[model samples]
Target: MGDFRRSRLSSTPVVGRVVEWKKTHGWIEPECTIDHPEMAKHQGHIFVHGEDLVPKWRNLVAGAMVEFFLYYDGQGLGAEECTSRKVLRVTLPWKHAKEMFGESGEKLADFEQQTHVTIRAYQWCQPDGNNSDLPFLLFEIWGRPQAVVESIGALAARREQDGNAAEDTLCVNLLLPESRMWKVDLMQLQHYCSLEVSSSITITDPMPCRTLTIQAPLPHFRSSLHALIAQAACVGNLW
Candidate 1:
């Protein structure tokens, strides 16, 4: 009985290069420009704040390509919707982590050695159909509801495809980018999963899907296809 609607507000991901890096309340808050259609509507700038870095990440400079997650409840959303929400946490590139920690395959399971966080892959964080590269970062600022996330979350839970599931449980994968991968970074990600979670989420429960491609039924995400469709009135009744 996982509520896809409820989960939509939890947290979202983004990918981009650093536009600005600030020391906010002694923490690093970086603003990036995402190419999502919603971003295009906003003129393409989003703010992502991070409380603590893994010490090694302290040197992350501006212009560094990175991907991270943002949590925005949007109690007081305004025209500057991107930074309207609070940034609970942020993550850097996974390759950086792997490079720094050295092939931490089984080492990730032992919490005593963990000093970082991990977030899995999700549609919001991936690149759009039009873009050749993966989207840089993700943020959930208040606007209209995330029509696209809601649709995919609901549909994915209904069936299986690409060897993914066909159950009511929506099968959204969370750790593809490993940005603050709280799914596996147990000590740091305690807020995201069950208390008993200890290891990395390798395979996720999937829903039966009708297609399998780099970007299948859920396509043209960066353009915010569903959002565009909703805007155009093709699927007006869906909302």
Candidate 2:
């Protein structure tokens, strides 16, 4: 299950067309003018203009019905518009998602911290606008979504002292697709079932937040691990 806190606060799916793209917005890249009916129906829904930090997204055209996720921050305004926040992910057509997010395509893993992986799509897009340059006609690779509904308490704890297996006193857990996992040579447990490693002698420390994406792995488990390891070094029984 996805984290209830994360799902409720962030990762709200919004559907709308790129109504406009004004060059006058700025220099780095144009501002996305998304028109979602949810805003009108909800009354106080704010017209959000999100930024696409992905340089390749420069080809996005107006009038394209795109699926995207919004970041959340409690505010007095009816609908929060985070100019600083970009789309958590954009869902495109299935065939299109493969071409775009597939290995040879956009390869979003190279950029974003992919997690809470999912596949979603809308029926169709209006027959107007220049959506040909768009990767998928009706599908999107919903890459980043939410944190896993898990906690440190849910994870089994263990201690290690020597050998490469026990080398990591603690580590952040990350789940990655087999395909992307192949390209990345980071040290990972071969068989991690039930959040447990398959054959790793090392005791895996699942990260506090269970993220689904393969994104880049975190170096250290957490700062707390440093102190814990330091004290454990002397006593060897603090855990």
Candidate 3:
């Protein structure tokens, strides 16, 4: 049997928005509530130190998005391995498009028209040390066209009408490299799998990138992920 010791801290990173930042320390309002029972004892904000910031930034502006692993040092919940999420507009290439939206068939044409999609990119900091100049890598991309959303909504409604549970989630897929997969501990991944934010991950066959599909809750997805799409859409409207 595998070792089943589960740490109270989070192994996978969670998304959050910065609440405030002092010179040395700050607080972040997590996108989802922390599930640990001990979390009720303190305010919901996650403590973050300046040193923990990836690339070692001095101050984080309020409302800036970030991702980090959660930790509790017997005192309070804190954030570590923090990194800022940079949102940008990206046009997916045909090969990439085939992988993500191939199921859409003729609808792929519609997706092509809406090529300028919003994605949250993160700095690829080195494990040994931080390098401020490293280019940002795309972490999360929203490619769901309006037609797809309507289709999903209809399917959900039908399920609810049939007395089945409604599926209210947006899939957040990750494509991770096979070489790095060995370094990740399956036990730790299993532990975090119970959380709503990390539950939808599915590891498939060996691929060039780290990929998993996560069924993110619709409400949280709207507030965090879809908000970027809305902002990008507004910008497009201005032009």
The candidate scoring highest on TM-score is 3
Ranking by TM-score: 3, 2, 1
How much lDDT does each candidate structure score? Answer: 0.28, 0.29, 0.48
Ranking by lDDT: 3, 2, 1
Identify the runs in model 1 with alpha carbons over 4 angstroms from their true place: 1-18, 22-151, 154-157, 160-169, 176-239
TM-score (all chains, Cα) for each model:
0.21, 0.23, 0.36
RMSD of 3: 18.2
Per residue, candidate 2 scores C-alpha lDDT tens digits across 151-176 of 21112132353655444343333332
Model 3 per-residue lDDT tens digits across residues 1-239: 11134234776678777888887879988876788766665477888888788867646777666778887776667888787654322223334434545533344344433542223333345567775442222333323344223322221212132353454444433343444445444434333221122233322222244343323345443333333333332111111
Better of 2 and 3 by lDDT: 3
Taking all chains together, the TM-score of candidate 1 against the true structure is 0.21
Model 2, position 134, has a per-residue lDDT of 32
User: On a 0 to 100 scale, what is the lDDT of residue 193 in model 2?
Assistant: 19
Q: Which parts of model 2 have CA positions greater than 4 angstroms off?
A: 1-46, 50-168, 171-173, 187-219, 222-239
Better of 2 and 3 by TM-score: 3
Lowest-lDDT window of 10 residues in candidate 3? 230-239
Query: What overall lDDT, based on C-alpha atoms, would model 2 receive against the true structure?
Result: 0.29
